[model samples]
Target: MRSYSSYVLIAVATLLVTCHALHKCPGIPGIPGLPGRDGLKGQIHLPGLLGPPGSLIGRPGRHGLPWLQGLPDSLDTERHDVLVNLKHRLSRLEGVLALNGKIREVGDKILASNGREVDFASALQSCEEAGGTIATPKNEEENKAILGIVKQYNRYAYLGIKEGQTSGQFMYINGTPLNYTKWHQYEPNGKGMEKCVEMYTDGSWNDKKCNVNRLTICEF
Candidate 1:
């Protein structure tokens, strides 16, 4: 038969051993449990039923105020005036250009094709479009065109026909048969053996050569 206190002491020692066995020795700690349903979360608030969505808002807001002011009348008037002036100048230039052929000349100076400006290239192209060939002193049309370009503009230099070129002979412009000629130092001996012709300021042709450098005539 055991004594009651001895039995109690033995039970306590056994309980301690059982608790130690349940937990591993030098054990690794467990991950904490899932946070527990969040406890219904966030204030448990219910928005007061939204108050029926706000009434139509004061009669559609009254139209908006006519946008912006249109431009003033004076601005329109000035723009129209500028356009008219431009048109007048353009017309006057065209009239003068027409006169140069009878007033006979080379056309423009600055050989744009050589250092050819775009405008001159276009003019050359335009003439080609019109069934006209590029004008040279020898060609009758070139002699005329030169006069027009010269009289209209001042900043150009019109190169003259060389002193002794005669016409009716095969002159060369890129190897094309430019037989046209003008005589500068001589007069019209009925388009003389002077096959090479140079242009005169009064709008006429004379015989001359390719080498002469006179102020050239150009159409701008």
Candidate 2:
């Protein structure tokens, strides 16, 4: 009971001191405080979150083919793995290196047709896909055979050699009569300049500046 009374006395003493200090507080005439500078403008950016920038093709409408969902703006947010994978697929596009060191681009259909050494059948199909035509000449007499072949497929075409500079030594395309260049002095004669052009079956070319009227292997 005595401890409780002592605590009450201490609390009364603290209140008395606070009251005395408030009473003694003077009427201080106010001095002006420094005015705060106006707050800086917030960033002047647009309010709403923005979408990805338009592509060169712009955003595609819904025709129901492959469509790009908008890409992420942040570089860190983009899926780099997908782009890497697409690049890899592009590099692996199926194609064949021709005997002439030219490229014969093809699709999966070409790979399916199996043949000995090379796949001419599949290559022909690929050529058609590429808007080119094909032909087969049995012998030297069949140089005109390409006309029928071209008429059958695209109006324009290129002849593929069965062997390098061996089978008939030439072929034809549309109608323009091209050939392996077999050039010599004063060739394709009978006139002042009736030059004859020739091509080996191996894609090699020659021209004769004389009157020897050799058959041509044309490409339109």
Candidate 3:
């Protein structure tokens, strides 16, 4: 009986070896296991580049302080007295200037003449050299004053009025518009041709050629 059992076990072992050599006895597959946990987070290498600068500006500064004190009362009184004294001195000086036959005072204006006849250009130069300008009347009183000088010289005198850019439009040498005028009847007919103005013996104004000889009357 022992020999028989031993022979059967040897037969079984030989069969298992033959199956493995022929690769015919593969094991049965098992069921899959559960999923694994997530891995650790990655480490940062370097920080991101710096952001651009801000565009906002600063606020405005505060206002300055006000003035402290006022002027003294005695200063006001002194100013008034000084102005009165200056006006009196000016009146005396005007009187002295009028005492001479060459200077005539009408109102606050002083009209004078070199009593010489010259063209309009020469008259302007002569008056400017004397620290005065050609006589320009702003009113009838001033006009009469200039007319007196013209009558005294017994010749026509060039006034400070002239034709402007437009014909028949007159202005002062300083480019101010005419505030007063004494245009004679049917006068200023030359239009653009007669640029200079002259005072007649009758104390009226007429537009005349600049080259004409006229008395050099100046005003201060």
Candidate 4:
């Protein structure tokens, strides 16, 4: 009986030690679970209270640059008046130039196309004063040009042709032989009486008294 009792005691002690070791040992890790469906959206938060009113609305910012100085009103007015006067002066100058241009045009036309009428002696003197001579046509072109001026007057005009040293022969004022003649029919009838020649409105040459007043052309 005593030996059976000892065997039972030993079996109980061994079983208790085995139970204590199992309680202290680590266990195998388990696999993680699948991700859960997205949680319901979080609630929205309300805006925070407004900050205290900013620094009692600070003083206005300073100007970046100084204001520009300006001319006095009186000086500005004076300058404006001076500009107006200058414009008027310029306009007057333009008008004077226009008048001068007109006068020059008329003078050129007269010099090219016509001459004034005067006594034969005055005509000769005028030609001399103007640095020209009494016109003497030496060819058909010159005759026609002189005749154009004489026809405008529609009257007798003095020519430079006159009796030469030989009584009946005619010559130019400059002593050139009168190579061209346009005498009218039945003209030069005065043998030694007529000393000068004149052109009629018809452009024909005729003997005339030297002192006669007539239109004249000066040639340069």
RMSD of each: 29.8, 25.6, 36.3, 43.3
Name the TM-score of candidate 3. 0.58
Q: Indicate whether candidate 3 or candidate 4 has the larger lDDT.
A: 3
In angstroms, the error of model 3 at 220 is 0.9
Candidate-wise lDDT, in order: 0.42, 0.35, 0.79, 0.64
- Candidate 3 per-residue lDDT, tens place, 114-204, comes to 8889999999999999898999999999999898888877899999999999999999999999999999999899969999999999999
lDDT of 1 at 126: 49
List the lowest-lDDT window of 10 residues for candidate 2.
Answer: 108-117
Per-residue lDDT over 1-220 for candidate 2, one digit per residue giving the tens place of the 0 to 100 score: 4585565566445444654566532223334445578655443222221122333233543443444333344542456777888887755653232322222223211212111112334445555565543433333334333433333332332334322133233224333333442323443232423122333343223433322322222221
- Candidate 4 stretches with Cα past 4 Å from truth are 1-115
Arrange candidates by TM-score, descending.
Answer: 3, 4, 1, 2
Better of 2 and 3 by lDDT: 3
User: What TM-score would each prediction reach against the true structure?
Assistant: 0.25, 0.21, 0.58, 0.48
Alpha-carbon runs more than 4 Å astray in model 2: 1-71, 74-79, 95-199, 206-220
Give the lowest summed-lDDT range of ten residues in model 3: 47-56
- After superposing candidate 3 on the true structure, give the runs of residues whose Cα lies further than 4 Å from its correct spot: 1-97
Candidate 4 lDDT over residue span 1-220, tens digit each: 4485565555445434554566532223335445578644433222222212221222322432222234466766899999999999967875674455311112222222235667768888887787777777776667676776677667678888888767677888878788889999988876767878988877889988787778867766
In order of lDDT, best first, we have 3, 4, 1, 2
| Segments in model 1 whose C-alpha atoms lie over 4 Å from true places | 1-142, 152-170, 179-197, 209-212, 218-220
